[model samples]
Target: SVCHANSIRAEQAETFVADRLKEIVQLPEVLPRLVAALNEEIVRQSQPLEQELVVLLERKEELKTKIEKWEAALEDSPELFPMLKDRLDELTEKRRQLHIRENEILGIFQQGEPIQVKDVQRILTSLDRFLAQSEKKQIKALYRTFIEKITFDPNHKEM
Candidate 1:
């Protein structure tokens, strides 16, 4: 009796989750606009970083030129070697800083490829069919694939 009751409760839970998911996946109409907005936002945010990376790369090249000049003069003007070395060190540090900043900006630009609406609709349709016909084990596996946890409110008898 205990096992039967537990089995019935599990079935009910599976139905509840599947029904909720089906309701949520009815977003084929809105998904395109939502995806476009997300992509536009990403591009807008990354545009500044892209421009800054270009500037940093240009500055890095300038620093490299100065460091090269210092290195060349350091060999020829031993008398001013100390001053030349100091300048070279400063230029090298500036170049390093530019490199670090370039990397940071590039990281910000490294967003994942945008999701296509058709792919999402296809997957949602498949999921709807799966949920409609899945056995308990298959339902559990489906839940595991898409969900991390499910919290229920006892007072409301809802998850």
Candidate 2:
């Protein structure tokens, strides 16, 4: 179950990374350091969740082993055995709850969709506003540089 949860979380994290990379296309300056920073953040957020799942699975296994030992010892004392059984039942319940939560979180991760068009439009609008506020000469130079990068086919209608 932990393995499954980790897998789902990884997928969600990758999707987030891809979305961010796509958004980077709009930025005028493509800083390698900024790209690396974003990648680091994605890994940082996902790694802790993966570690937590590993710990949960290990603890669950340990609890199961302890419960088995207690059960075996209880066969000798019927009265003492019931108390041990109750404790085991409590531990089992806790494990069950953990499993349910893990599965739910995993399901949410798997079901998550990419950011909507509205979100992209909002981001682009913000960027446009920022660019508009810059000096006209600078903006024109930037625009000309971008325009000069393309080669128009002579057969096509001239702009």
Candidate 3:
């Protein structure tokens, strides 16, 4: 009895599916060729993203090689040691300034004011100016310190 009931349900499901397919086939505006064309376009659009990823991977490899070469050069030059040290010190100072600015910005965000596009632009411009000035000062200091170190070194070879 159970097998007979299951067969009847299966027959009803097959009839329903056939009816739906017939309705779809009878539709006037649905074109299989257009659907296939749209699907092909979607596939074509996705292909460029794969190409972009490959380009990015190649760029990353190039940058890695450049960075490794720079590191090796720095290691081979003893004069670069003190210059790098000064640069690191300058970076630390700039980072401290940035931290203060970040905290101020966070406080502003916490104040619940509606930030407009102009406000964001103004803030970004101000930050850029401040960082540029700070970087200039840091570079000047670094150069001065490097020059002083070079002059003070007893064993320094004039180049």
Candidate 3: the clashing residue pairs are none
By summed lDDT, the worst window of 10 consecutive residues in model 3 runs over 150-159
Highest lDDT among the candidates is held by which one?
1
Best by TM-score: 1
Q: How many steric clashes between backbone atoms does each model show?
A: 0, 0, 0
Query: 1-159, model 3: which lDDT tens digit per residue?
Result: 111432434334333433433443445344354455655765676556556555655654655565556567678996786667655555455545545554554454455333343444454455445434676555345334423321212243211
TM-score, model 3 to reference = 0.30
lDDT of 3: 0.48
Candidate-wise lDDT, in order: 0.74, 0.58, 0.48
Candidate 3 residues lying further than 4 Å off, grouped into runs, are 1-35, 78-159
Poorest lDDT segment (10 consecutive residues) of candidate 2: 1-10
Worst 10 residues of 1 by lDDT: 1-10
Clashes of 2: 0
Instruction: For residues 24-84, write the lDDT of model 2, one tens digit per residue.
Output: 6456354344545655666666666777777877887887787777777777677896568
| Per-residue alpha-carbon lDDT of candidate 1 for residues 31-100, written as tens digits (9 for 90 to 100) | 6776688778877877788788888899899999888888888778878986667677778998999999
Q: Which stretches of candidate 1 lie above 4 Å from their native place?
A: 1-24, 116-159
